[model samples]
Target: MNEPEAGAAPEEASTGAASAPSGLSRRGLLGLAIGGGVAGLAVGAGAGLTGGVAIGRARAAEDAHSAYEFFGAHQAGITTPVQDHLHFASFDMMPRTDREDLISLLQDWSYAASRMVQGLEVSATGAVGGPAEAPPDDTGEALGLPAAGLTLTFGFGPGLFENEDGDRYGIAAQRPAGLERLPAFLGDDLDPQTSHGDLCIQACADDPQVAVHAIRNLSRIAFGRARLRWSQLGFGKTSRTTAAQATPRNLFGFKDGTANILADDTEALADHVWVSSNDEPAWLAGGSYLVARKIAMLIETWDRVRLSEQDNIIGRDKGEGAPLSGGDEFTAPVFDSTAIDANSHVSLAHPDQNDGIRILRRGYNYVDGNNALGRLDAGLFFLSYQRDPAQFISLQRRLSTDLMNEYIRHVGSGIWAVPAGAEPGSFVGEALFA
Candidate 1:
């Protein structure tokens, strides 16, 4: 649910071997062992090197298409054009863990995430080059897959700062004043199991397996330090961060995010999305706040409504996604026009009505099979990044009166202070630890 510039030195799988271990990179060895035949067993010897060269060759080709740098001013996924799929996960630090445990966890995650984004495996040993007796550092699912425009964004939840036991990581004072659990909203039937966590990672990629692989391996890397609380898989991106991409649809079959803040809009981004240096908590400068809402759509009930009524509820023509007041999809809505309902979704969430507030949205549609009543348990996984949590709080409160409220329920919720991106050799959130 973010944006990042595309550029990473594609780590090519090596085609030759017989080099000193100190001189060769992990990928180089993996490339030689898997790309070339026998006699090139510099590492992981007798660990089965007959897997074939297709995977190595595939990695090279995939890198050429999508490989975003993991280090920047802000995390990539937020401004990086929203990918086709999402694998969002939340985690909790294990009890009895000290500050070092937390720091090391972030370090491990950053190291693995940086490599994965470059179309490389989680470690030098990777899936096939590890010792025969030990588990490989990376899961094999994504070995042959390209980066697929994958971007992994990490965030620290309120619990990470201070939980019931108090200041577990000794950084409670650094928590932003607005970083607490989101207050209950109207029509909220949130489930605690999926509501909050101590940490969260948003992995996005065009390929579902690649996205899943990232979370899977990162979770494995956590081991005793932290445990995953909950996760969600999503597809059919509900919003666009770049104008080059088309606005995608939610499960409700209407165009979404027609007027979302674009990555190139630096002025708007600074004003609405990224946290500033002058803001509180100097450690979080250049970072942003992420609010995740797992909204459940009443699919069966909405389907029974007449087509025109559906348009009225959303305040946009389902066909062209234009405001009912006229003009194309991108045209400003004429809220004064009688054609637009005062309580319509568009009218209530419009920036003009909300004191000029705007948020960068990166949402996705999810269908998690049928519920007990034989209805599709599908809806929108709403993800938005704003400079302040109050921005979302205000908007959600205003939406309580929207016409679309009858068709959706907020089922899962979480808020995390997404720190600025890591520098080339540093882990994400390093400033916070410092």
Candidate 2:
């Protein structure tokens, strides 16, 4: 995707500027229009309009852009409407950094993240305003972009509390009992390079570029304090968060998250998503646990299987995504029905079969081109949030018996303690330090 040249002017510019090139991207043109000064809008000679007026107009135009608030009781991305694109990255704190370094990093991240979520630059001296001798404060690719409903959710991995160095941050005593490296599962062919980290950020937006831009700039902001461990780009969201969103399909083409916990279900969220005040770690009261699994699908092999067999494995019809027990997508499955296999994916994952356990899923499909074997390296990057990590552990343990396991391999995995949203002047995870 090529960006518009900075010097070009949009067709709508009334400054009598020449038209932009035919190839000017829609995003580039919008940027020029919204930026106010980008297209060289010369104020009339007789009118004594100050540059501040121009900047104010630009700020007002920014109000029309789509955005989400960064400060709240809970992070925006977790239960916020699932976006179409994702740029999820994990990071490790730099060696020898102290608690002050960690605190400063969080503060800096929150400040920049707050601005970016509003369609503003990461800093007051953003993309082009910094001293010419210094690098730009922002990467500038999203210069003309709207927020595109961008959301950045941060989390702490077990390592952030205690690692080989042992209680490096002095917050080890506050670590949630359930916040640890997940145990090895039945079919996990785990890759060490992609799993685990001291910190993680889940960036999501409607536009792929917007999502990428958030992570890229934040990674830059972490220059000395932290380093990115691994990242994944995903599209075609595999789950829905609200009732209005239609169920989405995974790489297997089966509608996923049909029975997922919705954002508006307060009781369900309280019981299964948000951490209660009485929970062991008081600091994580309103937060949740995030579990990420990179499941690789054997596309060629699955495609070769008969349609009926595929449906049987999933316990739902591939076409309508209705249970084989004869109901619509949302109908409760009759697990005992002869048509539904007890070991089927749906049956094994349903709450009825697992003591009413549920997780809010916000996942996406990813295609990382091809593997060395010439086979497509494509699969589902599974993301789920729960009040307790044990919820996921037990569910996953039950899934070991899933018939669909034959076609999928869990290649990468991670778990993080997603802190509650930052207050107006505080950074995320401030409660722990306080």
Candidate 3:
């Protein structure tokens, strides 16, 4: 899609921004009126949240801009309401890139992200004509469009710190012990190129174009500082982060996130999600660890599985999504070994079996067309947030022998330290540098 160009104007002239839901705000139009001006009104959520949620301003027209706040105690995307689309990118620093360059790029990214989330261009000059020799600041495809409730969450991978030789960015001392390389597990087929990066950006929005535009502009801004390693475009979010949003289905047709951690669950968030101040690194007090896995689903094989077998493997009703042993969808599972398969997917991965450990999952379904083998290339792009990496590791270990593994393959994976959100003048991950 063409990026928003500065000269482009909206199709209709509308005034006044419609208020969004609590913890979400309505963003007004971005047209000829403010073509080259910075959005003095930065993006923000209506209700103050631990992790920010960008609320989009409802335009006078049908469902135009829904803005989510970008500044808060924690980054927005992790615990925010799940958007319809995801454009996740991992980046590697240039061989010669140093600490100072990394810091500069981060600052630039923060400013640009803050502006874009408000439905403004990356800079005051944006895509409009500037010095004839210089390219437009923003690509411009998103011009004249509302923010679409965009949220960009940033994270630093384990590689960002000490390398084989030693600390590369001179901040290895600050690396949290909880942030480390994820160990390989059973039935793993991780691709080296797609598995790891020094940094990552997760941009999500109700509009695909808006999400894509954010990543494109950020990559442009990074220029020689950091280059994209791998990115996946995901559609159909498989989880819910707020009570107001319904649980979404994954590509496998299962209702996912039925047991997810909602934003309103302050107790759960503190216990299982947010990193506490006493965790040694005072800078990471409100932060969380992000785990990403690119899972490949064998749709053909799954389609061939009998409905009874499918339900047996999943331990849930195919249509109603209720536990095989249960009453309603959200009713606590009985974990009855006689009624459900002992090796069922849910049975093994349930918190009951994993020392009562749970992770806040924010997964999305992905379809990347067909692979070389002429099979459908698609699966759940699993994303989860947790206070400690041990939670995820324990769950995966319990699922090593899950009946569902026959139809799914774990292909790519990475773990990153998602630091606390920035104040107005600060950039994401600025604490480490300080």
What would the per-residue lDDT of candidate 1 be over residues 343-410, giving only the tens digit for each residue?
Answer: 99999998888888888888988777777898887888899988999988989898888898898989
List, residue by residue over 1-434, the lDDT tens digit for candidate 3: 00000010011212333222121001111222222232111112111111112333223344556576676778888777777778888988877778888887787788778877878887777778555565567779899877876788999998889776567689999888878889898989999887889899999877766877888777777766677888877767888777777767777787876777777777778878888888858878888898999998999999999999988988888788788987887876787547678788878877666666777877887776677998888898898888899888878877887888899889999999898878766788889898
Q: Model 2, 1-434: lDDT tens per residue? A: 00000010001101111111122123222322233221111112111123222432354443325577787788889878787778889989989888987887787778777877877777666889867876666779889877777789999999999888888899999989999899998999999888989999999877666777788877776766677888887777888887788888888888888887777777888888889899979999989999999899999999999999999999999999899999898777888779999989888888888888888888888887677899888898899888999989989999888998899999998999998878777788899899
The CA lDDT of each predicted structure is 0.77, 0.77, 0.73
- Evaluate residue 413 in candidate 3 and report its C-alpha lDDT on the 0 to 100 scale: 94
Per-candidate clashes, comma-separated: 8, 1, 21
Q: What are the RMSD figures for all models against the true structure?
A: 8.7, 13.0, 10.2
Question: Candidate 3: where is the Cα deviation over 4 Å?
Answer: 1-63
TM-score of each: 0.87, 0.85, 0.86
Model 1 residue 298 CA deviation (Å) reads 0.8
Q: Using lDDT as the measure, name the better of candidate 1 and candidate 3.
A: 1
